[model samples]
Target: MTETWPARFIAAERYRRHRYAANHPLAIPRVSLTLDLIHSYAALSAEEYLVSRRASEDELAWFHTAEYIEAMQAAERAGKVSRASRQRHNIGNLENPYFHDFFTTPATATGGSIQAAEQVLAGYLAFSPAGGMHHALPDQARGFCFFNDPVLAIMRLRREGWRVLYLDIDAHHGDGVELAFRDDEQVLTFSLHMDTAYAYPFIGGGWRDWGVLGNALNVPLPKATRDGEYRWIFGQLWPRVLRAFQPDAVVLQAGTDILLPDPLGKFAISTGFFLELVEEVLHSAPRHPHGVPRLAVLGGGGYHPLTLARCWTGVWGLLSGRRLDEALPEAGRRVLQAVGWDEDEDEDYYPVLFERRVEAAGDGPPREAIRRLAGDLLEQHPLWRGMT
Candidate 1:
């Protein structure tokens, strides 16, 4: 409803119907819930809601291989991956399983991401709630992502002549996206994720593993990292990186799995902290040499349906210049209540719109460890120097 913000919500109803099969971590509704909740709160109007378009094979080929794309399409049509396909592409593995509409579903999300990129290049803020499948490879599926939508989106933006500042705030490292642009100077990647000992894609993102071109900074936070710790490190590093990179556009992989209740993640952040980072990125964009820097926001890896709905809905609100209220509206409450989960442990306490205050876990690694993490990263002098 607010015209001043100049934002659009890129989503599709097909996300509700074509989802991961039962028993999968991604089986629960995400984008649909966020869309419904945003509608319920009157945060997005009909004019602002754009139906997602499906990515064509040609568009998909911008990132994925033609043979892999054909294999995925074949698997989708047959409702299964062939033995060879499974072995080569990791398609039927437990992490990335064969499911109905696998190709088209991810293609739709990819298309939305591309559209969001176009909108950002045109000087509009675009949030694609279904994008950010950051773990998929160009030829293989990994960590439940069939297509690396964020990579494709960023690659498209780069082709249009924008120096990209990629910030990933997922609990799990964005290995796929990081690997995609590791050697490219046009895109500077910074990821703040959980330590690999407890997270998925349990490789890379350490302090020492700067990308081939040293354009990447991977700050691996220890387990149970709370808001204070996240805020401290992000504040220390991001401004310097932004000032150094001076990107023409910013793309954020906003994955809320770091929220406390998420079953798949280990961090203890709140929805508020997540929004704070997003707001910071949005505000910094205007300072770029390119007048009115563009931003493309993508949803990444949140597992809990309630957290996904609240965090992303809050993101949509912030993108549109609305702030969070302690108490949610009645319609919003109904939307949260309708969310069905496999477990019924905390139904009474689930619908709160704001993250509950949580003390930093003293049992995890000490603050000095985090300081050392940053120090070691700074010791990679050339990477830091390039930005300066």
Candidate 2:
């Protein structure tokens, strides 16, 4: 078994055992599929895989209210929710849903995130594919998330005196994480998501919503955005901002919903570009402000099961320093083929595990909108103003 990589993968069988409510966007297994693909491809040794634990109520208390946590636990135990509990805690609704392990599953993912944070702090890298439930609020469930694991992990990092940069590439804005550290200067929350004007959590990721002292910068992209535009915008501003923030640690919500054909996403980004984006982030880790070479990666949102499996398995490849094969081996292909999705309804033949290279869309509203957003951030945010 190869053992040269300085990273660990957090996962367990429980992630596959518990699933979201039927017909929900998250009902498909995400982490488990990633694990299976990587294992099938022989990407990591047994020593590199860490079984995730469940976050205790105390750990959850760092961000969530005790009453809210108790209510969720009660709902899970009883396998149902009272009308008042549902109304108050936002559980039992179609968006949040009621199911056994509703609390336990998220708690386990939170535990994995917290553990990954600790690993990063210790000068090692870790990827928790089940973490990054970014839209959950302290007291309520929102946007298919019941627990905000990224917020919990970031809050824990803050307590250790580490400056954190919360970056999200999800289709939806990271409203909950931004709100958690909106006023604090220690954490800089930067998200590039679809404009919330017509998307879920329709309140954040706007240029006008910069946090205290320019701590939060939201670059809202237009629908059907292409890879080149994203590359252009990110290349123009993000490197300068990262240098300015000089974060002690970076917690990236690496959501793959931006890939084309995602049921919930509007962007036209390909999986290859998504992998490249993560590669850039990893490459910048050593130059962090605090001289801390630590990074914690978490999975956020990807409704397409095959895409999630491919993208996140690629994430594990990058973190583990394993070279990925362009074409998946037969074993890995079998793993992805086993996943049931609406996409599979058509006639067969998905030969590759990674997305094929493609060109960016031509000029339009999406490009113009991204340019404006980038210009606003570069011109207005304190981090970019000095650079300008």
Candidate 3:
């Protein structure tokens, strides 16, 4: 057999065994659920299996302070929290509560992301479903994220001489990532998220938060934007960035919450459109914000279990270059049912959502929404000043 792109999957059954309590946003058995989906449906070859290993202390130190890791370790030892620890790092809190594997489980996910980036750098299209913890900050974590994996990966790639283009499609703003490289010119961050006032991580994502690189780009759309508007803004930002910096690698966080039924997000995008979006990324092979074209696609944040699985399964299949049959395969459906996810038979899984979706403001996109946003953004970026 021809040696295909060296694919890898970073997961451990142990990670699923040690999980958050049920009903919490982070409780779903992500790697396990995704594993079951692939086992039943995907034509995954042996090479794609890249089980996760915890990122080493030095790796964590790349993007996190020792004190932060110290705080996490201390929180782990006590099991039950004490007042002193609480005051130091806010260990046990409403949002980022202590979970079963609070200390190390997230590390596996972070490690997996780092591994994925390594494979991509080695010249293969790589993905780590456990990655995209974009909410974790260097000093602390919020929103069930303990460490920012993608940030760590970008920092790692930078040390190796690759200019990185960070793309986040999570419904919530990628505040942690944006903050980490906010001042560094080597990294260019692009985010399209639901407006902060209406979503979690509610403090940022303003287009004006342009990082020190003056390369940060934000498209804060109103709720209910569908394929057209979503594509428009992305269309605008991606082209200009490619023209300017021409990145060597692009890290995309494909969080599924933007789908219609996701509790955490308000947008009603379907999975089909997402496949096309990635397709475009490969087709254009943007001007290297880095030295070569590569990708590290990841699962950022999605609360709905089955929906998340369905959305990402498409991503995996797309990367493999196989067309999905519109009808869900029986074996795949059986796999989903094993996890108590019933099929929404009426739904279509390709090209467009079963329903004809619209943009935000309850009206479809205006003729110039894409041009206006892209035009406005380009006017301020350094890439436009001859970087490309």
Q: What overall lDDT goes with each candidate model?
A: 0.81, 0.81, 0.73
Compared with the true structure, what per-residue lDDT tens digits does model 2 show for residues 52-145? 8888899898889998999988887888888998889888988888876767888999999998888887767889988989999889998878
Q: Compute each candidate's TM-score over C-alphas.
A: 0.92, 0.92, 0.88
Model 2: lDDT equals 0.81
lDDT of 3 by residue, 130-207 (tens): 889998877777687889998998887787888888988889888888889877887888888887878887888466
Error of 3 at 343 (Å): 13
- lDDT by residue (184-295, candidate 1, tens digit) is 8898888889888667778774777677787778888898888888888887888888787788788899988998778899998877777778888877774323444378
Model 1 CA deviation exceeding 4 Å by range: 1-3, 287-293, 342-366, 386-388
The candidate with the higher TM-score, 2 or 3, is 2
Badly placed stretches (over 4 Å) of model 3 are 1-4, 286-293, 341-364, 367-372
State in Å the error of residue 148, model 1.
0.6
Clashing residue pair totals per candidate (backbone < 3 A): 0, 1, 14
